[model samples]
Target: MTNRTRTPRTRYAQSLICLLFVWAVMGSNSALAELTIRITEGADAAIPVAVVPFSESEGIPSSDKISSIVQDDLAMSGEFRTLAPEKMLSLPSKRSEVYFRDWRLLGQRYVLVGALNRNGDRVEARYELFDVNREERIMGATAGASANNMRTLAHHISDKVYEAITGVPGAFSTKLAYVTRDSANGEPRYRLQVSDVDGKRAGIRLESKEPILSPAWSPDGRKLAYVSFETGRPVVFIHELASGNRTRIAEYRGLNSAPAWSDDGRSLLLTLSKDGNAEIYRIDIQSKNLKRLTNHWSIDTEAVWDHTGNGFFFTSDRSGGPQIYHKSSEDAEPRRITFGSRYNARARPDNDGKFVYYVHQRDRAFHIAKTDLESGEETVLTRSESDESPSVSPNGRMLIYATKQSGNSVLTVVSADGGDAYSLPASQGDVRDPAWSPILR
Candidate 1:
């Protein structure tokens, strides 16, 4: 019994050492930063708003300024145009200090004011959202966070402000899962990282010398399913973010890749070549029971569940070139969905199943495009040269994908309607295979 106890301690120490090494390597290299967001172009009709600078009380640290991060989050969404502190006529941190007439003259539609107060070890933010035209406080709340988690508190405030105005839940507090490649030390090193949606405070969830791809977040956003080549052959592993634990869910003969979580989070739809050709199969996560969904000799992969949970949309090369296809059920036959492009694959539908987005080939250049399920109209959404792996935001307002610019691969987020776009580039390496986490309630 003593020996068994010692063995568990030894394993815990080894795991801790591995994590320390990962954080050390990541910290020493500033180029491996949490993504830096750059708004390439903004929407023409963005809502005009002002986020007043938050006044901090004495004895509290700046510890990631709350107001600045909140402003950036709202601006990055392409939904709001936030006024700078310098341009504001008055810096008000409370309702009593706000002047409605001055804000009306500035042509602002809405204004957010807040102040940070420190009590003991916790920092609390007292914030209010108001409509300039109506001269009413639309929302008010107090949110607190630990001293080390000010960024999270700021994002939470952003989410609240967003939901109150847009009627859609703010995805600012949600996380993003992506793969970054850094070969600075001669041999290549890959890291699977999760960070805030605005790209701050990123932490490596997994590190390897091998390649990692196709990170899909579970419905609850607590776990990530990705393809790792750590075992010589490709295998799909489900990794829990809170704990550094992972389980190899699929390792078949030819290919076990492109793991897509179902809406209920009970199973995953993956591509496997064990049965002869690349085909789509569903495996119950706990029971490990396999069910084949597609038997096509052509490639049938990149499957994603529709919001309805009754059907799925996937990519296939059945119609000579790759195109989008949808199946209402397991036994239902797939019908082609994309007709405009010769190569359109990786279909990701919005939460309401209104638009299906994919990588589209236009004028010999790859761009991200979406097709309206109701109107049967397809509109190209990106202007980049090579864009792929599009992942939609939880609110269906924005979608992110991997694109190449200036010889480096960067992640770009564009408005769902192709109105505005921004790029998140690493300081040194290539960032790709972005999967936006679902909104955690």
Candidate 2:
């Protein structure tokens, strides 16, 4: 894992530039485009889930919207499409109230029911998951939290159900940092935000008139690295949580952006166009020394380190159009990861090293997709007309991507396998360039 280093504060877009790049790379989205996820092969189909309304056992404040939070948590995973309350054939509160036939009619394979018991100063929650098809209880748990901790408890339940059904550790408890740009009357406003993986507890990490881009967390989740234009140009800076001090790590002449931390936090891999064209470079944090990793003249950027931290996956136009490529420190040759997508592709490595999530372009829009780096299988994760900048969670079970809804940019998290998917409604402005943080307690 990359150990994130703390540095100083700075700056950090919806640009139709991404759309132009999509068309220049892939011929068109209308043609049966090659998907990246299909490269990875079969993921257990998105679990058909039904989370029954939760029960309140205790006298906790009735104002705590716990159930709503849990639903958001599960719905964002993308591996399970939650059955809406309106679509559910039955809403069971207890095991006896659960009629397999009623749930079956709703096309649900798994069901969850929960209740909250009010503790003196805290609350206790008991939740259960049922394998409706098998007529058996799959799992159950009891959790306690203060009123303010309701969202955290909801995440816990989601993590449990996700692991039980997918056999992969759930990342629902993680956090997300993304950039939002609100443009009104040709004037642009930018904000950097940190939100729960389920879109809760969102706090403004920093805001500025200049754009703030690429919000990445330290491995320990105590700091951030991003590019800011506050100084009139793009500069990469590191921010420490303890002191709120920001350090400028990279400030080249032409372009200094797209910062990614190495697994050990010893170095940063980013894109620099100072050498005439956008290329990848690795910088040692301690020595302040930079080593040019890619010497390509055709735009090469968005370098993502693999799970081992010894290698990276990036996007490049060396093949004519943007495509995903893997480069390891041990090898001089860069290997191509995506073959089907022509328009555009960005590599998002899973924590488990099983797959690489990416964006695939179709027609004139971009879609979130993933590929099995080993099997060469690909699957599409979203059907949205314009979606990009997918960020994988620390556990590799889910992804967060930027989407444009009603002409406004927003952040959406989805299970890596395409289970639950929903938008993180922007409280202040539009959102984009989401970067998921590694687990931080």
Candidate 3:
């Protein structure tokens, strides 16, 4: 094989080969680890907004401040610069108390204020947003949840405030599915976890000593489909989040990996090697019927559905090195979509169909890059040298991917246009295979 051919295989396929070989020899149990987010870069033109601390009623128990969560959510996006509570001239809990002059003097373009009250077994929040320049209330609402679900209530409020101000729905309430690996007593432990977009309230869904890869979320945000090797071989399983129930979906003999959910959530696009070569296949989730999509001698894997479910994008080495290809339909001929890099894989397209993101290797470093679908112009989105597994937010305003930080794997979030950046590093070990969940209904 030529060096170009060997490089793609080594960078992508070799890892799979090694994982399969290692899973065949060894196996253990796993545990959960929470991720902590830190803002690494801020956008030059970020909007200035003030989120005042909500006043709590008498006798209400102390808990996490809702305003703090909202500030973190907005600041983490890199699109907003939130003013600290200590810097505010006055803490307003309602529209009447907000002084537009004071906010404008502080250079804040917008302000959010609210109050919390106890109502039986639940907590109710009355929140309002004001435009400092216009001196008018732009949005106001009353939202409540069980007292124990304060975080949920806070995220819901953040979503509303974000939508009213940005004209785009916020993803603060969305979940992220990823794989975390760490050693326990010298034995490697693998865990599949789901957490809020800010890396809080993380809960373990599956654990194994064998490596887990490719955690894909269903359209409805109720389940996850991923590849696991706990049975001494890689197998695809659909895990129901609410019940902790897992159903084996793909357990072929040779290779079963890279499970991706369809837009409708009725079927999946998978990469299997049962026929002797790794190629793309579609399987009906309910009927268990399998249909092969690609017939190729070269490795074809990491398949993902485009904005429209009628087509898909996958990584294939058919030409020489691993490049991205798209098929209009299952029976349609595949058309190559990337040419600027010899190693471009893990295709993730935005929901609006404007651009497609993936891992692009330039020189000796790998970075996350995107191609404008209309103009075919490519732009590198990240400066990190070891970036992979790009996932776009539901609104297509932000992109998340895994990269190496301090010689450890960490997830980073950047705006879709490649502005502002934040890092979500694990408390221990490494985190990879990030999958952003769809907007909850």
Candidate 4:
């Protein structure tokens, strides 16, 4: 019995040691750079689409072309192969100007044409998507946003175009919450940042001299919950993006970490060790009511709600090594869900309830793997040796996770089926703990 108890304890200690080592070596004297995205892999059967460069009104300020941004968004999804504007025989910003024969000859299946016009303090986009094979207009819309929000408008157009082509909704407009670590003046600094799914237009939400980890987004996409070490100990805080207000949520005597929000956003599932050993607990966000969910000597943490919201998936070490488990309710016994690996944790389930994704260790390398809930089939989804923090897009069509690229930590996005990959790498320092936000209303 004593030996059984020591196994998980020792494993946790080793993990902590590795984490500390990573932090110690991540110190850098470089300023944070705007995340640049690169397509690492593309699907072989990607649909060929052409986004004609949008004609901008003379008064519109020079910026990234809306059609170009839309093209990049589709290309990054790995589902679409976008045609370069320079290779196009003609640039048409309207339906009447589009010649179906020209696009068909170019081997394009679909074409998107758009025009941007500047209004008083605002920019209006008129866009249309056409099926090249059928020579039919499938989608069209006119959207307007503040002149400074052209990127947002472009993302909205991308989302509409993607949904029109595929049955699944596009996640281009969704936000990603992550942590960045760097060194300044020989002291380490950590920042919690939120950015577009493509890793553009990032804004820091919080900055501290200590560490920040496990950022989780609220269901409504308005707030973020995460753990911080600013006070010399791990404490959970809920930050409101609009107001920049932070409220202390959890500061128990011992470890406070891994904040996962409930489906309704009324409470959060937290890892707290105040009761003696690390365990999972659900706390009400309003009244601060706390209820223990897992009663075990082994460490139980990283809990996430299943699609149905009646059950949850969490990581536990009761079976000797960390593995994924699921419980139907707060009092139900957790059923082990991962056996292919000696170490697996951080279960993120899709909205369809078809699969649960987590970090799986095979030999000495860690990669993101997903388990088919019904068939019990497990598939490793990444080739990276140091992958962690898997966050599925709200639509379940794409996934973003942290991994090492050129020895520096970065975030990579891949299709849900593990086809194609694009990476968002920081110019300096290390980025980790990515949380994909739900589609905003």
By lDDT, the best candidate is 4
Where does model 1 exceed 4 Å of error?
A: 1-33
Candidates arranged by lDDT, highest first:
4, 3, 1, 2
Q: Tell me the spans in candidate 4 whose CA falls farther than 4 Å from its real position.
A: 1-29
Error of 1 at 174 (Å): 0.4
- Model 2 CA deviation exceeding 4 Å by range: 1-52, 81-111, 132-137, 183-187, 362-364, 375-381, 414-420, 425-428
Root-mean-square deviation of Cα positions for candidate 3 versus the true structure, in angstroms: 3.4
Residues 54-90 of candidate 4 have per-residue lDDT tens digits of 9888777687678878999999999999999889999
TM-score (C-alpha) between model 3 and the true structure: 0.94
User: CA shift at 210, candidate 4, in angstroms?
Assistant: 0.5
Q: 3 or 4: which has the higher lDDT?
A: 4
User: Rank order by TM-score, top first?
Assistant: 4, 3, 1, 2
Instruction: Encode model 3's per-residue lDDT on 51-138: one tens digit a residue.
Output: 9999999745587678899998899989999999999999989978888999999999999999999999899999999999999999
lDDT by residue (275-361, candidate 2, tens digit) is 556778998878879888887645678887888888888888778788998886625689888887686576788876889888898
TM-score-better candidate, 1 vs 3: 3
lDDT score, candidate 2, position 203: 69
TM-score of each: 0.92, 0.78, 0.94, 0.95
State the local distance difference test value for candidate 1: 0.85
